[model samples]
Target: MYLGSQEMRTVLERDNGTIQKNLKKLTFYYGASDLWCPVQYYEDIKKDFPSGDIRLCKKGIQHAFVTSLTSSREMAAMIRDWLKDDLAEM
Candidate 1:
């Protein structure tokens, strides 16, 4: 995840337009109590990318949700369901 995230960040940093273009169609899910990410970052992202679908986790899952199979499954299912409409159109 770290390597992929860094690579993607590098690509996006090369062009602000690229970030904006892709971000416009993104749905970001941030943990409500994420220790790695402060709440202010989430607030700022919402303001910065108003067109993006940003949401806070309401299921009480910690930032390290991948550590638990149940949390991972739940998040995967939710994301798949969320993208179903756009995926179908594609």
Candidate 2:
């Protein structure tokens, strides 16, 4: 499901503000490498949600970083730690 540039622009302009406002109440984890989605996208999202956990892998992992068993385990562990910390604060 891909939206064209114009469609995406319209959707973002209409909805991004609401999304950004609501993000303050949620904990977000975003991981991106130099491989698939450009690091800039993550950076932009980080700007939108300063409290989010935005991790950028300088090693340039593939888009499917979690497909490998080891990578999946590591990802799971990272999320587990984040959730623990988040829950602890509540």
Candidate 3:
């Protein structure tokens, strides 16, 4: 399965609530650089998801930085690298 990137239709419909709940049991490594999800959502999700490992990337830029190139590619890459590192620990 893909590490990230959910189906747009399901995401727009908020069908991911159940999946989000399920993911509560799994580790989470959020991009501190995220604009779309943001740190607020990450904090909220972490609150409900205490069972899993929680972390954030202390990098620069917005959420789209990962998928976008504009100056923040390195920051996004750092976030992705952090995710990989954390996942390996899991």
Highest-lDDT candidate:
1
Please give the RMSD to the true structure for each candidate, in Å. 4.2, 4.3, 6.5
**In angstroms, how far off is 19's CA in candidate 2?**
2.7
For candidate 1, give the lDDT.
0.79
lDDT of 3 by residue, 5-86 (tens): 5554345632346746677455556777675667886787668666556767665555565466764768656558867886
Q: 1-90 in candidate 1: lDDT tens per residue? A: 898698867855224476588985777788888886777767878887777788888898888788999998998899888889788978
State the C-alpha lDDT per candidate: 0.79, 0.62, 0.63
Candidates in descending lDDT order: 1, 3, 2
> What is the TM-score of each predicted model, taking all chains together?
0.72, 0.61, 0.45
User: In model 3, which regions exceed 4 Å deviation?
Assistant: 1-9, 13-25, 61-90
lDDT of 1 at 76: 88
Model 2 poorest 10 in a row by lDDT: 28-37
- Cα error, residue 57 of model 1, in Å, equals 1.0
Better of 1 and 3 by lDDT: 1
Candidate 1, superposed: residue stretches over 4 Å from native: 1-17, 88-90
